[model samples]
Target: MNIFPKAQFLILLSEDLFSHPQETMNKVFQFLELAAYLSEEYLP
Candidate 1:
């Protein structure tokens, strides 16, 4: 039996997120449909 889902999985590395916080968060927010809640402080 498979433990993890094949189609709805996302792998995010800490180093990448730290290096590109704004860009990474933008993608995450968009994926979660929370872009409308994002504030201007999120951008650099």
Candidate 2:
């Protein structure tokens, strides 16, 4: 699966996300090549 240089496929679990919100989000952000600008205060 070489669509692009950054192309990727990720499978996340509900239990893992609920148990480790920050870690899970970090993985998502890193995969998307995004900056972690939204802090805990910005979340609902």
lDDT of 1 by residue, 1-44 (tens): 29876645656787777787777777777767775445556433
Off by over 4 Å in 2: 1-7, 41-44
Which 10 residues in a row give candidate 1 its minimum summed lDDT? 35-44
lDDT of 1: 0.66
**Superposed model 1: Cα runs more than 4 Å off:** 1-5, 36-44
Q: Model 1: C-alpha RMSD to truth?
A: 3.6
Error of 2 at 28 (Å): 0.2
Cα displacement (Å) at residue 26, model 2: 0.3
- Scored by TM-score, the top model is 2
lDDT of 2 by residue, 1-44 (tens): 46655356777897877777788888889888998655573231
Error of 1 at 14 (Å): 0.4
